[model samples]
Target: MREIIAETNRLQLCVPTMDDLDGLSALWSDAETMRYIGSGVPWTREQVQERIERAIGFCADKGMTFWTVVEESTDTIIGQGGLVPISFNGDEIELGYRLGKDHWGKGYATEIARASAAYGFDALNLDRLVAVCYEQNLPSRAVLKKVGFRKLGQSDVYYGVHALLHECLPYDLVR
Candidate 1:
């Protein structure tokens, strides 16, 4: 599995290791971050471990995963973001992230979303990448838009809240 250490102007992106358990578990267990996910139910330690295992498995299976987002200077994991395998119209790589509440409203979401999409296209050689955000998640929708992802359509899941489906294609990059 490839541990892609992506460097932005102020952030460093890397996969979660064993040492990240405490931070990530805490982040996911927080009520705010889990609001849109599972109806604000705090995730259990076992669930967190399962998620970590799945992310690491993505690296082994597809050479990519939802990596931790850190401020390069402080080396603090402010969030998690990456392109992981998913299925929508068919097999696709999806963009996902969970930022700490303290790090919200800083455009970090858009910054990393764009970078993750770029990595999927440039490094993974994928023609198109997709993302799904809960209908109520305006911030996530905005991030997808800012990153140049177009809303192809929506889906009626999680009791008709409408998961907005978006895509980033190679042709879009040529613009």
Candidate 2:
């Protein structure tokens, strides 16, 4: 069963399932789409499978994970976004999102970021949320700023690569 966690005007964020493998594989396999992601390399189908499984486990154990983003009108899995434990630092939750290249520049990133922050602060009762993006990922940085994340400068703390770190509190949210 697909559990819908959050919704926007055109998208629904849902807990990932095995059924999302194909769509996720396609999204994560695109080099352009994976450019700003970890190691800046596309993921294999098997990697996608493992990630889906991890997402399921995270949902069951922590009540949150990177959720599958579905297009409301077409009912298509267009991306993934939500809250997840900071891999390198378990004490903090991170808000993140990724979208198919076709969905870029459509304001979906901001919507996803806003939804994720809301879920973290409201549903998960999180006091603080953090986000990091590649230094070159200006668009992602912009989205974070638009959603009320204060940039805390560059840090190599989360992912192995150096990234721009940002943090947000419930009261810091713009909307």
Choose the strongest candidate by lDDT.
2
Candidate 2 Cα errors over 4 Å, as ranges: none
State residue 125's C-alpha deviation in candidate 2, in Å.
0.9
Writing each residue's lDDT as its tens digit, candidate 1 over 1-175 gives 3244687777778877766778777788788788876456878878878888887788778878988788777777787898887643457777887798888998788778877777888888989887788878999988888778889888664234568878888766422
Tens digits of per-residue lDDT for model 2, 100-154: 9988999998999999899889888999999999989999999999999999999
Off by over 4 Å in 1: 1-4, 87-89, 157-161, 173-175
Query: What overall lDDT goes with each candidate model?
Result: 0.78, 0.92
Each prediction's TM-score against the native?
Answer: 0.88, 0.97
TM-score of predicted structure 1: 0.88
> What's each prediction's clash count?
0, 0
Candidate 2: count the clashes: 0
Instruction: Give the number of the best model, judged by TM-score.
Output: 2
Candidate 2 vs. true structure, TM-score: 0.97
Residue pairs with backbone overlap in model 1: none
